[model samples]
Target: MISHRAPDSLSTWRAAILIAVIALLVSCGKPPPKEISTLDKIRTTGVITLGIRETSVPFSYLDDAQQQAGYAWEIANRVATAVKRDLKLDTLAIHTFVVTPQTRIPLVANQTVDLECSSTTHDRERERQVGFSSSFYLTGPRMLVRRDSPVRDWSDLRGKRAVVSSGTTAELALRKLDRERGLDIEIMLAKDIGENFMTVETGRAAASVQDDVILYSNIARARDPSAWQVVGAPLMREAYACMLRKGDVPFKRLVDATIAEMARSGELMQLYTKYFASSLAVKGGVRIDQPLSDDMRELLRQPNDRID
Candidate 1:
C-alpha cells in the first residue's frame, strides 16, 4: 500500500460531504414544515379544532354527555361559522378538545388547537405566549366565602387561608396583595377554579378568590347556592377572550374583525342575554342563571384586549 497524506482541501471536502449527507437525511426523514397560519391549517384540513374547558362552568364545561358548551364556546362557534364562511368551505367540521388552565397556554402556543374557546383571560404576560381575540367578557377578581364567614374584605383575609387556582390572575393578584399588604394571608393553591371554590366548601380554606362571573358559575353549580357569598372589592379587571396562536397577524385581524362585526350587529349581546342573562339548562338539567353585568355590556360597547 502506498502511504498517503491528506490533501489541502481534505477538511473542506469532509465538511461538504457532511453537509450533503445531512441534506439528504433531512429530505428523507423530515416532512415539509407545517404551515404556520391557523387559517391556512383550517383551509388545508377542512376542520377546526376548538379547545374548550372541561370545567370552566358558565364559560366552558363538560356536560353529562361530555359535550362542551358555555357562553365562551358559543362565541367560539360563531367565530367558527365566520371562519367557514371566510374560507368558503362547503363543509368545515369542528373538532373539540379539553384544555384546563395548566394546558391551555401550551396548547395554543404549539397550535395543538386552532383556537382556545375556554375562559382564558387576556393579559400582558400571557400575550408573550399566545394571541387573544377582542374582549368577549369582562370580570374582576372577587372572594367567595361561607355565608357565616367573617371575611368581608381583604383586611379580614389577614392570617386566613385563601384558595385560588394554580395558574390564574386571581392567584397572582392574591399573592401580590399578600406581599404588599403583608396580610399574612395563607395562600392555598387549587388545581382549578372548581376546586378553588371547593376548598372553601370543604373548610380547608376560608376564601376562594376568582372572577365574579366564575364565582356565580360555581354558586349555580353548588349543592346549596345560598350557602356561599361572593363579596369584597374587585381585585383586578380581567378581559376574557378566545386564545389563539401568536404572531399570526392575519388570523388575529380576522378574529378581531369577527368580534367587531358581532359587536356592531349586536349579535354578541344577544348571545350573552340568551346564555347568561337567563336561566339556562346546564349539565344534569341544572338551571343556572348568570345575568350579564353592566360592565360586560360596556366591554361589548368598546371591545378591548389590553391587559391593563
Candidate 2:
C-alpha cells in the first residue's frame, strides 16, 4: 500500500528555488547574444531599410504608381543586392522610408535607415554626422523662374521672395549669398522640392533656388513645361552620394564597391541617360533633357567620395 500527500510549503519553496538556480547557472554558462551591428542586424532580420525622397525628381521620387523610382533609387537597389549577396541571404526584404531634407540626416544617423540614396549633398559639415559612399552625381544650385520672369541671375533675386527647400545645401548657399551681396532677399522655406517649386508657380515667390538638375526635372514634369525655365549659372558645385551611418566601414565598403563597379562597367552612364536624357515613362512622359557634364564623366571614370 502506498500513501500520497502534498509536499510541505517549505519543501515546495525549496524545489522552486533549486529550479531558479539551475536556470541561472545555465544562462551564465552561455555567452550573451552578440551585439548586433548594422550588417548583422540586416542579416538576422532579412530586411534593409532605405531612405528615399518623394519629390527629388530624377534622383529619388514617386512614379505614377506612387512607388519609389529614380536614378538614386536604382542605385540603392543595386547596393541592396550587394548586401543580400554579402550576407548570403536567400531573400532580403527592402523597406523604404520617405525622408525629407530636414529628416534625412537624422534618420540615417540613428540607423533607422540603413542607406539613403537621394539628392543629398556630401560636404565636410555633413560628413561629421554620416558616412558617404562614392559621389554619384554632380549639380549646383540654380534659379527656376517663369519664362517671362525678369530674374535672369542671382543678382535679380534682390528684394524678391525666393524659395528654397528647408535644410538643404541650397538654403545655406542662398542665405550666404543674400548676406554677402546684401540682396535683402526675402527667403521662403519649403518642406520639399515640390513645395519649393509650387511657391514660385503660385507667384508667392519670384524664384525657386534648387539644384539645377532638380529645376530641370521639375520643369519637364510641370503641367506646361514651356512655362518654366532654369536660369542663372550654378551657384556652387555639389556632389550627391549615398549616406549610411557614421563609422559603418563594412557597409560603406560594400556600397562604394557597388558604385565603383557600376561606373567601370558603364552602367552608371546608361542609368544617367535613362533618367536625364530620355523621356520618363511616368508623369506623362516628362523628359529632363539635361545632358551629361564633363564633371560627371570624370566622376564615372573615377568614382570617389570627394565633398564639395
lDDT (10s digit) by residue, model 1, range 1-308: 74477465689899999999999998699565444799899999999999987667667876677677787888888889989999999999999888877788998888788898667888898888788888888888899898999999999999999998887788899999899999999999999766787788999999898888878878878999899888998898888898998878788888888888888889888878766766555656554465557777787877767666
lDDT of 2: 0.89
Q: How much RMSD separates candidate 1 from the native structure?
A: 8.5
Q: Which parts of model 2 are misplaced by more than 4 Å?
A: 1-36
Clashes of 1: 0
Instruction: Quote the lDDT for 176 in model 2.
Output: 95
Clash counts for the predictions, in order: 0, 0
Model 1, stretches more than 4 Å misplaced?
A: 1-35
The candidate scoring highest on TM-score is 1
**TM-score of each predicted structure versus truth:** 0.83, 0.81
Candidate 1 TM-score over all chains jointly:
0.83
- Compared with the true structure, model 2 gives a TM-score of 0.81
For candidate 1, give the lDDT: 0.83
